[model samples]
Target: MPTETEREESWLTRDELEDVRGRVPMLYVIAVPVRVGEAGDLDQVGLLLRASDTGRMERELVAGRVLYHERIRDALVRHLEKDLGPMALPRIPVSPQPLTVAEFFPTPGVTPYHDPRQHAVALVFAVPVHGDCAPQQDALELAWLTPSEAASTDVEAEMAGGHAVLLRQVLAHLGQTL
Candidate 1:
């Protein structure tokens, strides 16, 4: 019998993952965590600053691939903790429905989202997070910005891979205007 780690390891190697990416669209979940005020209005938006493939700094949301047979909720929790640290205490939504969907095509201009590595379909959520958030893994830092700051031209220009569009969509979904 294989352990959970063993089972995960047996799922796919690097070459196999590339092959699968080429053959099918990968599943992804993206989280836009926010802080709410006492009146239930949005307070701050969280964004991660990370190094991209080109070694340039870029802003991004909390995102990760959903493993085979894994539940979406579990994947969301895993990715939230992976990027936001354990003490971040993300408030997972009661409903499984996403705020929006972002389809990333390999070719640029096909959509608002683009992923040069693979074609990915991401279910995006606007998560309300309590507790302090610390950047984890390869993330350089986490920036907490006001709705206006997040939608600012400087901030939008700093984001790569269409995350700016996604951020705008998230803000709009949250009833915040740029």
Candidate 2:
């Protein structure tokens, strides 16, 4: 059997991934990072600021693809650490479950989510982090906001690709919808 590293090394190249993505709905993991109060109440949600492919800055949740043979929980941890620094310390359960499943279509209006590059099915999770988070990789900054603030029109306008809708779903799942 191949080691995990070896298996990861066998992943498709960028062009191959794009070709396959066009032919099928790709699976993805989306995370909404949260900070909890002493009572374990969700105090704030974390969103990343990044410049999109279109050259405009946008707000987004921690999200990425689940590699071949990778477990769902492992994917969550990997993306969280990749986007939110290694010290984010996400609290993934032993058997993690998603808050909801979101489907992003290439065409808009099919669903609230839209990804023009490809159709993607995302398992959305609400993850709590106990340590400090410094935005990493393509993320310019990590902004922690209250649920109401996150639901505001200003923040909503800054988010694209259905991230604003994802925020509402996550907050509703946590019983903190604005």
Instruction: State the displacement of the C-alpha of residue 143, model 1, in Å, after optimal TM-score superposition.
Output: 0.7
Model 2: lDDT of residue 163:
92
Give a tens-digit lDDT track for model 1, residues 42-134.
999999999888898889999999998888988898998999999888888656789899999999999989999899999999888898889
lDDT of 2: 0.92
Model 1 vs truth, CA RMSD: 3.0
RMSD (Å) of each candidate, 1 decimal:
3.0, 2.9
All candidates' TM-scores?
0.93, 0.94
lDDT (0-100) at residue 11 of candidate 2? 82
Best by lDDT: 2
The count of residue-pair clashes in candidate 1 stands at: 0
lDDT of each: 0.91, 0.92
Runs of candidate 1 exceeding 4 Å displacement: 1-11
Q: Provide backbone clash counts, one per model.
A: 0, 0
lDDT digits (tens) for residues 15-75 of candidate 2: 9999999899899999999988998788999999999998999999899999888899999
Per-residue error (Å), model 1, residue 21: 0.4
